[model samples]
Target: MLSPLGVSYLGLDDEGFAHFLRGTGAPFASVGALTFLFALLSLGRWGLRVMLSQKHPYEPWLWDHSWRHELQDQRLTQLLVSWPVSLVLLAVLAVVHWLFYSRVFSQGHVLPGALLGLVLLGFDIIIFTRVLGPTVLGTLALLRFGRMRLLLPGVPLELGSRCQVHLEARSLARMSNVKVELRRIREWAETTGCGDERLTQSVTHIEHSHTYTVDAAALHEGKALALPLELPEGGPEHSTALHASRSCHWELKLSSEVSSVHLDTTFVLPVYYVVGGHPARAS
Candidate 1:
């Protein structure tokens, strides 16, 4: 019923479709196997480099830390953590495929959908395990490296107590006129327990201290300024304790004369008890 050219075109399309389906298994298997093999080879190479470098001479000054070094450390750490999990997942997927194929063939029904689902699932797992998961975890780990201790107070304090937080900075000779802001975080009642009315009111309140300025010379020399935090007259009641914790966030904006460099760090403070004689247990 078809014209000669039309029939030839239809035949070509059918041939192409059949070839695709036939080679599907080969491509999937090859890609997965190759990816796993390449990852393994890369791991080996990095391991060898680390091992060989250990025996080589090193200099203390060369250990100067930067963002790139931090990033590499994070990548190695993530690879070590996630690679085993990915291998186990791959093995499980293989077992599942074998089981599905056996059962479906014995039942005399085609499980095209199951086969397709397995392929999709395998691809998703491989990509996520190898790429996305490692990238996210590495980024978070790197960000938390030097930044964590900067913001935490050096000393611990009981809840409801007040403490003074110090802010320090180093400026170059050409820098001047920097603005700084401090943010306070209030503790909240445990979500699981019945919401405490007094705790709610205490945390909802906002109290702020004055702002201070640092000269260019003082900043260049890395001098620090201190500000005292005031506590409420009475600590939190027996049922409610002062929810104020001693942590402050700082933001520095430099004038045009100075280079726009942003520095953030946490300061740790000793815990204090306000009206309440004792610290409230974490809920």
Candidate 2:
């Protein structure tokens, strides 16, 4: 049977399906199967490492790694993973179209072929808009505002203290309604189910937050606005683990209206707890 997404499922018993999967000799099928197996093994290894680290308390380098570096790494990683997955989906679509065309042409069936062609066209539009379109738009947006930058203090933010930040932009003089918000977030992963049916998902919670508005006069002067934010007291400290399974951190979100354009951006903040003039434990 074919689903709304044009995915066809064969009605077979578990053992028969296993046999069918084992008998398949398609190159793309083999690649996908191997990739799934590799992913399963990698997840198992990562879970084992997480369990071991809990017992032996190893410090994560994320504490020392600057948020700017993390931001860059995240963007690069997204591009790397998204491009390959998008290309693979497009290839699969091509393979499915070819197979459908061959079988339907041999049977001289125009109706089924036309229906499947429409379905494939729908899938093509979805893939382009959801994957390829966002990538192109993000690249263009980066190019448009490549010169604008939000500068933060080099020293890490301590709990119950204040930190200074600024936005440097040559075009900000023409913008108005500048707003900034600092948010504290807690994140973790929860797993459900047992054995091969297990599933894991990441969760985020906003623990604390604050917002500030830049003065219109600052924009009129065409100078960078010095933004100072106060950290909340008696809250969780910044903590990150392997594969980012659990963590607490802060982010600064900025927005402004510039004539026909609206500018919005977010930056990760380095917020850590300090004790006796030294970085302390995570809460």
Candidate 3:
């Protein structure tokens, strides 16, 4: 039987549920329910913050956009992004606790394995930093390229077509030498095996590439740099059309390095023929 709230159970299974009860905390089921709820809350909070940032950005609840008054917002957006990660870590910890109670693991084994799990999640965090870093820390604090406008000769960009590209970028500080590369990259995941026992692998392929030098003169006022490049046929199979990746994708990759940090970005575009992609909306 379960509580009226449907959160905790009164009776127990002799093995799994009973064993779970005798741990450090009481009423493990209630705790588990709360953990998931907290996780959902974290997810919701971050998502709401993301939407709000685009609008109010920073605010004085009583007034408005208080963040604008200051050159920098004191609140760290990275912490907001990290709250959900804590929930993930908690969920994993609970699972580790379950593994111990289930007798599937020994006491010593659980600690190391749980630590390994945390380490892996720690690694996954770099993704958030890279993705949201530019936004959270501002454009100058991170390497960012914006408003990349590519001009192609007559037809849609295709095999052996030479073109000029222009874009604006921001960097943490000025460097003596900076280089830019434009390339087409293909990435996809493939799964092998049957039903529940399948294996998936991530694959990234660089189909074409060209490099240019961005001189310090253009860095003045974050000016757009004009680059000249030539394209090679990615393949007979790959289309010039840049489309969002479902299982596979062909992306226009723009990248560079500043100091020790690798700064790169990609735009979806058609580099071949007739592959369908979403078109830009005109204002």
Q: For model 3, how does the per-residue alpha-carbon lDDT over 62-108 read when each residue is reduced to its tens digit?
A: 11112111122222344454444454545555654454434423333
Candidate 3 root-mean-square deviation in Å: 12.7
Q: Once model 2 is optimally superposed onto the true structure by TM-score, how far is the C-alpha of residue 109 displaced, in angstroms? A: 3.3
Q: Residue pairs in steric clash, candidate 2?
A: none
Cα TM-score per model: 0.29, 0.63, 0.44
Candidate 3: Cα lDDT at 187: 67
Q: What is candidate 1's lDDT per residue for 1-283, written digit by digit as tens?
A: 3334322322223443343335345545755787799799978765754554354313111111111211111234555555555555555455544544543344443455355556758786876877657655555443432222122243223343455544343334555544434333344433343556433322333243335554445545655434445433323221121222422221222122333333322232323232233333221
Better of 2 and 3 by TM-score: 2
Over the stretch 8-119, how does candidate 2's per-residue lDDT look in tens digits? 3333334433433344436477568769987999787767666654653323233333245223213434556676777677767666665566544455656666776788
Q: Whole-model lDDT for model 2 versus the true structure?
A: 0.61
- Which has the greatest TM-score? 2
State the TM-score for model 1. Answer: 0.29
- lDDT of predicted model 1: 0.40
Return the top candidate by lDDT.
2
